[model samples]
Target: MKKFLIIAVMALSLGAYAQVDPTFEKEGDKVKATYFHANGEKSQEGYFLNEKLEGEWKMFNEKGEKIAMGNYENGVRTGTWLFWEGDVKSEVSFDNNRIASVSKAGKKDPVVSNK
Candidate 1:
């Protein structure tokens, strides 16, 4: 039973991943790419230079809600990025595709308490 459950979960996850396969179209010097969710909603859209991610990018959840927005240069993430999680918002900064810093602002912050 455990093996069957594991296999079922794996298959479902893989199916979800496969559903968001990106599609690319050449636009001048850059290739614009757009990914779609399993429900046929836009997941993310951006531009690529020389086959590497470049310029601004926006990401959306399966429900078609914007979740993240950022910029990339030659496949390296740069500048500030904003992410939304429920009522919480996070700001992430990246340099050369590496996370530089992160800040969260919301009504609540999760913390484990031991009494």
Candidate 2:
């Protein structure tokens, strides 16, 4: 009986960690999306244009800490992206979805032009 109870508890715990499907809302021509972690915490939010990722996107970890932020132009990564891990912050530049360069800084760094 104890073994059966333990198995049931484990199943419940696994179910609790199952990720929820992302939600989408249509706003004019853009579709706003919100994705959540298995813990029911928001993991990311962004917009889609013509079924393609577009506009500003922000991501957070399961602990609800901002992990990355950047922009996608017509599904292609563009502009500057910022990532955080521990005490280190990384700046990544992208052009047409290709990484142009990356740098580390203590504070929010300015956007690096691909030119």
Candidate 3:
């Protein structure tokens, strides 16, 4: 009976530790990151913050397409966000409490401009 109780306690302890927490792993420990799921699929992914995402986060679609990747400013997206698709990339700059600009660099700058 004592052995059985000890085994049960050990199992419970391990289970608790396996749960995601801010202390999930050390700074350099090799461990898989945590993620958020939507519609039965992994959609929003981010690093842990007290077991939650505190800084930046990335969201994706079911087809493995990136939808949005931006800062989670203390667990909430607060700054400009960048999005990408196939061969396109764009950034929505935020400044003075407004969108400063949307810069899209479609191609590399020419070494020399045509007159």
Against the true structure, whose lDDT is highest? 2
Please provide TM-scores, in order, for all candidate models, with all chains considered together. 0.72, 0.84, 0.45
Which is the winner by TM-score between candidate 1 and candidate 3? 1
Look at candidate 2 and give me any clashing residue pairs.
none
Clashing pairs in 3: 22-51, 49-52, 72-76
The C-alpha lDDT values of all candidates are 0.91, 0.94, 0.62
Candidate 2 local Cα displacement, residue 38, angstroms:
0.4
Off by over 4 Å in 1: 1-21, 107-115
**Root-mean-square deviation (CA) per prediction:** 8.0, 7.4, 12.2
Task: Give, for candidate 1, the lowest lDDT window spanning 10 residues.
Answer: 106-115
RMSD of 1: 8.0
Pairs that collide, model 1: none
Q: What lDDT tens digits, residue by residue, belong to model 1 across residues 1-115?
A: 9999999999999887775577999999999999998878999999999878899999999899999999998798999999999898999999878899999998574587675
Q: In every candidate, how many clashes are there?
A: 0, 0, 3
Please provide, for model 2 over 1-115, each residue's C-alpha lDDT reduced to its tens digit, 9 standing for 90 to 100.
9999999999999998797899999999999999999988899999999999999999999999999999999899999999999878999999878999999977655589676
- Per-residue lDDT of model 3, residues 1-115, tens digit only: 9999999999988775553332234354222254534334456666655544455667777676787787654344457888876567788765543677787756466799889
What TM-score, to 2 decimals, does candidate 2 have? 0.84
